[model samples]
Target chain A: MAPRNKYSVILPTYNERKNLPIIVWLLNDSFTKNGFEYEIIIVDDASPDNTAEIARQLQTAFPNRIILKQRSGKLGLGTAYVHGLQFATGNFVIIMDADFSHHPKFIPDMIRVQSTKDYDIVTGTRYSGKHGGVYGWDLKRKLVSKGANIFADTVLRPGVSDLTGSFRLYKKDVLEKVITKVQSKGYVFQMELMVLAKAMGYSVAEVPISFVDRVYGESKLGSSEIAEYATGVLSLWMRV
Target chain B: MTRAQQTVSIGLLFASTQLYLALFLQLIPLPSIISEEIIPVLPLWALVSFGSYLLAKLGYGVLTFNDVPEAHAELMKEIDLAREDLRTKGVEVD
Candidate 1:
């Protein structure tokens, strides 16, 4: 028989107190309905909202399935993943937002796509397929996102539709290898991870997903982030 | 080779080849249509066309970007369900 696979979802949160419980519940529902062995690794970076308290409550509710890793202060997102990965016991690792922007309903679809071709990484994209889209984003936001994607696609030619999307499933080994090579710390981290993964010749498959903007919190994409992303793309173009 | 290096090298090769072709056409007295009109502005035309294509693609993407209101509605319902279920299961969810 094929070896049983477990999915460890690493959710990095700063102040996701309100959304955490619902997202976790949805994740549990999705996993249980699909009958997949999974564990949730919540890496709370000292969310001042006392997000860890809610995580502890969740541990009581679910027991043994929720792994909470609390950090001292607000480190960068890249380090948050690195911290969470150390606790992940599953062979497959999924990284996504705790703000409900990346719904857990699509996890099964990603898994199905991965199984079909054994893709090294499966990413949820909002740029491909008829069903893929975003909710609650204004025209300016849409333009910026589309323009950024086009700019990166033109320069890097990474062959991936969504370069900045964070919702992704990776073979545990592939993720560990790729994460080590990634150097960016902020918003560019997501883009760098995908580009470097492609450079490393890992096969990637895309799944169209509806990315609803964060329900409970503000989504940040400022001018500095955009400038960093532009430079990051150019640097990756030259390096990779 | 890196993508930047490959692009620059290929671009230089193409530009030099075009220049050589232009010089050869002038020396050989080829057809004016092939040598003067087309050869002189070939790169310009290509650049403009590529730019236009990119612009059109971006515009199309923006216009057709999916909204998915149903997803948000469904999620609200799911949040309610999740809260109820968690509360019943002895998890205090705010």
Candidate 2:
């Protein structure tokens, strides 16, 4: 018997108080509108701001649809997903940015793609076809992101259109398998997931998505992160 | 400019600036030991860096290229069909 499809959205947030309410609302609206049985697992890594407080209030408004998993401190992105996955009751899992960079409107597209075939993963790409693009970015920022993609693409050859995109849907089992194989946290974690999925022969689907820059808070891509991403790709190349 | 173009130009600009500085220092005739030791090493450093970059690129390309062509093809087909289905339903995939 085929199991019913249920979606678990894991949103790893830190200092996202202002963005949390809107993101949650959007997620709830999109999922309910599409008639998808879904639960949003928000893992807040002890944000110094009122992010968790906002999430708790959202939980009241939505009840069973919103699950808050608060940690003690600012954990890394990779671990946050892992932590959120523990409470996920769905057969499929979603990992996305809570900063409004990844809109909930694209969730339906991801679901539609996954439904046509039993793809192990459906990734949102900002570099595929006419439908994909990045908006609200300066030239330097855009160049850096593009260069990183090319560098990773040229080296890792992940084959997917967007290796660094956080917006993606994965069959729960497939995500569990790939997540264990990836050693990176933070920015490199997304890139490694695609590389590992392909290496493991899991089918990956891409949906064109418009990636908008964050409207709130400071951008997290600092010099240290770029350095980390480069070294991480090199290490993955050497090992994987 | 596209990100790819900007990246390439920036790389070229950095390389040219380094070359100009090296040539300028040579023209000013610094102490022979400092200039000579550094000059020989500069080219070697550039060569090593470029070589490593190429090797990493080629190595990754060779290692991961077409490793799962069949899987990729199947996945792409699924994505295309799904996109068409959604477009018919009036969902903006972009």
Candidate 3:
């Protein structure tokens, strides 16, 4: 068997005190179960809820496995990953939400796909195979997600099934290259990353993943974010 | 596009086809059931097909177009275990 590649998960959290512990535990469990070497870097942007404190406790429990990288204020999502990248020691970097929505169980499959195919990136999609789709979302939310994906696909034709999905694995160097090229922040960051990747001719693969609603905190999505996402999509269409 | 979305889109296309067919038959002055029963049934067919389309998007098991897979339940269990592990470590959880 080929030696396992070290996987570093850069989880960005903001006011996720209650969710921090469980997600870390699940990450630990999933990595151990798959017999893969992994590290989780918790990048908290000074959440007032003291999510950093809980992350600190998790670091103590997990010892060297969990690393906490703290920022002074709430920065954008794109920057959080970039900050976490400085601390990632693994050859592969996994970017996911601190919320429970993106399950860690699919991490092994992503790693396996990357190893076998030598793809530059592998994204977890909710629109792929039998095991894919969203749960705990109402019709409105579903429509919004589907609509955003369709609008982007019609304009950019990125060719990937799920353009807005955040759960993805990237080779360290490839991520570093593409991250620098992406200019969007907030909700559009994930979409822009994939668009840039496709435009740059990077090999991308999709793994079916089931997305669940957050079990703890309130969702950050709102009307303003949706409006911004639409504008962002249009802007990206013109530029890319 | 998802299977559920495709199902709904295709359903709408079928409804439109029926509507156009009925209109065309009416222009040709067909004396068959096409002018009476089939034309009236066109709207009813559209309504029923659209209703079924919504049901499919909602993951109604009868249609089985986009039902949430069983793997979710298992993943939820794993999450629960992770929570339990955290609680055992003396973290206060509700």
Candidate 4:
């Protein structure tokens, strides 16, 4: 028999009190329905809204299924993943947004794709396949996203359709290896991970997913973040 | 090699080949029109075509970008169900 696989979802959050409960509930529903052995690791970086407290309440409700790792200050996303990784015991690790932008329903598809050839990483994409696309974004938002993706594809040529999408399932070993090589901190982090994984000769597969923008919190993509993303892509082009 | 190195190497090779072709055209007495008119502005033409292609691709992508209202509506219902289930399970939800 194939070895039983466990998936640990590392959800990094800040001030996501309102969305946390619903996302957790949906995750539980998805996992239960799929009959997958999984655990959720909530790595909360001290949100004033008491997101961690809600996570603690969730731990009570879900018992061993929920693992809450609270950090002191509002750290960056990369560090949050690193912190969450330390607590993940599953053979496969999933990294996704806690804001409900990346739904849990697609996790099953990602797993199925990963199993076909045992891809080292299975990433959810919004730009390829029939079911792939985004909702709740305006024309300008779509333009920016498409432009960023084209720019990255031109420069880095990572071969994956969606470079910025954060919904992904990585074999624990591949994720650990790739994360150690990743140096970018913010918006560039996801792109950098994909590029570095390709550089390290890891097999990657894509699954189509509908990315619904945040339901509760504000989704911020400021000019400064765009500038940062541009520079980040250029730097990866030079180094990777 | 890194992507940067590969790109640079390929670009340099292409530029040199174009330069050699242009020089050969000038030396070999081909039609003056072909040599002077087309060869000189070939890179510019390539650039313009590539730029247009990228623009059209981006435009088509933006035009066809899906807006799934049904997903949004379904999620709202899911949220209500989740909230009710959480409350029933003795979990306090705000």
Query: Considering only N, C-alpha and C atoms within 3 Å, which residue pairs clash in candidate 2?
Result: none
- Candidate 2 lDDT at A118 equals 78
Model 1, A86-139: lDDT tens digits are 999999999998889999999999999999989999999998777689999999
What TM-score goes with each of the models? Answer: 0.93, 0.71, 0.78, 0.94
Any runs in candidate 2 off by more than 4 Å, and if so which? B1-94
Interface RMSD after interface superposition, each candidate: 1.4, 13.7, 5.7, 1.5
lDDT of 3 at A55: 80
TM-score on B-chain, cand. 4: 0.76
Q: Which stretches of candidate 3 lie above 4 Å from their native place? A: A1-3, B1-65, B69-72, B90-94
Q: Tell me how each candidate scores on DockQ against the true complex.
A: 0.70, 0.03, 0.15, 0.64
Per-residue lDDT of A1-240 in model 4, one digit per residue for the tens? 998999999999888888899899999999989999999999888999999888888988888999998889998899999888988999999999988888899999999999999999999989876778888998899999999998999888899989999999999988998999899998999999999999899999999888889888679988998999999999999997
lDDT of 1 by residue, B1-94 (tens): 4789889999999998877676656975778777877767877888999999999989998998888898899989999999999998777677
Candidate 4 ranges beyond 4 A from true positions: B1-25
Q: Identify the candidate with maximal TM-score.
A: 4
Q: Identify the runs in model 1 with alpha carbons over 4 angstroms from their true place.
A: B1-25
Candidate with the greatest DockQ versus the true structure: 1
Across residues A94-191, which tens digit of lDDT does each residue of candidate 2 receive?
99998777777789999999989979999998776455666556656666776788788878878886888989999998998888888888788888
User: TM-scores for chain A, candidates in order?
Assistant: 0.98, 0.96, 0.96, 0.98
- Binned by DockQ into CAPRI classes (incorrect, acceptable, medium, high), candidate 4 is medium
